[model samples]
Target: MEINKFIDHTILKATATEADIIELCKEAREYEFFSVCVNSGYVPLAKKQLSNSKVKVCAVVGFPLGAMSTEAKVFEAEQALKDGAEEIDMVINIGELKSKNLKKVEDEIAAIKNVIGDKVLKVIIETCYLTPQEIVIASELAVNAKADYVKTSTGFGTDGAKMENIKLMKKAVNGSAKIKASGGIKNLDTALSYIEAGVERIGTSSGVSIVKELKG
Candidate 1:
């Protein structure tokens, strides 16, 4: 398999600077990753840097915390698109999900998806805080919301991605939605295992090492 196609080369830290983003984009192009996932503020830079490539630009909205109002998330989505974001990975309203406010969670995701229209939308379930049942419910809601992918974690969370959780997510999504196992996927063995389990994309800052590991 082509490792480049399955990667969303990511750099979401608050400290990531302009030069860092430019370098990230350059590496993404060099590696031919599917996309470069960055903070919304870096969307334009990433777009500019990757303009000559087929690689897409992905921006995160309502990021690690999914507590922002629906309007805010919609605005963020619209703005990201305007700034040249081809895909948006948004955090679901985790608080609402935890509180058993199913509609709120669903509406939050749907609103962002509506704003993005045909563009890709990957909902970050932030599995570290959720139970198995919650993960299933979130996966169902993401499918209902018309999301293109249901991603595992927002790397900034208490814990990163986990294989068991990814397995559960894949089963819950049931092939209706694609799966992106993000966060701490560090090496070739782990990445390949996730792919074997049906994960379509992998979001990681360790993309370089993983690729080298896979080929080494």
Candidate 2:
């Protein structure tokens, strides 16, 4: 397999600077990875830097913490698209989901998807904060809301994606939507394991290393 194509080369740290994003785009182009994932604020810069290449730009909304209001996340997702983000990775409201406010959680996801229509929407369910049952519920909710992908974690969470969770998500989506395993995936073996388990995308800061390892 061309592992690089399955990777979303990412740098979402708060401390990530302009230089960092530039380097990210450069590496993405060099490696021919699928896309460069960045904060919404850097979407324009990333878009500009990657203008000449095939590497798409992905922006994160609601980020590590999914406590923001739905309107806020929608605006962020919209602006990111205007700024040239080809895909949006949004975090779902964990608090609302835990509170059993399933409609609110699903509506929030739908609100963003409505605006981004046709642009890929990947809902970050932050699997670390949820139970096995909650993981299944959250995955189903994203699919119900028409999200293109149900993502595992934010990497800022206490834990990241696990094989068991992937299994749960796969069964949860039930072929309605795809899965993206992010956070803590840092090596060729771990990435390939998720792919072997049927994840369509891999989000990580170690894309270059993983691709290099594959080449070796």
lDDT on C-alpha atoms for all candidate structures? 0.92, 0.96
- Candidate 1 lDDT by residue in tens digits, 1-216: 898799999999989999999999989998999999999989999999998899999999998798888898999999999999999999999989999999888988888999899999999999999999999999999999899999999998889778888888888888889999998888888889899888899999888888887778
Residue ranges of candidate 2 with Cα displaced over 4 Å: none
Residue 199 shift from truth in candidate 1, angstroms? 0.2
Q: Tell me the TM-score of each prediction against the true structure.
A: 0.98, 0.99
The 10-residue segment of model 1 with minimum total lDDT is 207-216
**Top candidate when judged by TM-score against the true structure:** 2
Task: Give lDDT tens digits, candidate 2, residues 85-188.
Answer: 99999999999999999999999999999999999999999999999999999999999999999999999999999999999999999999999999999999
Residue pairs in collision within model 1:
none
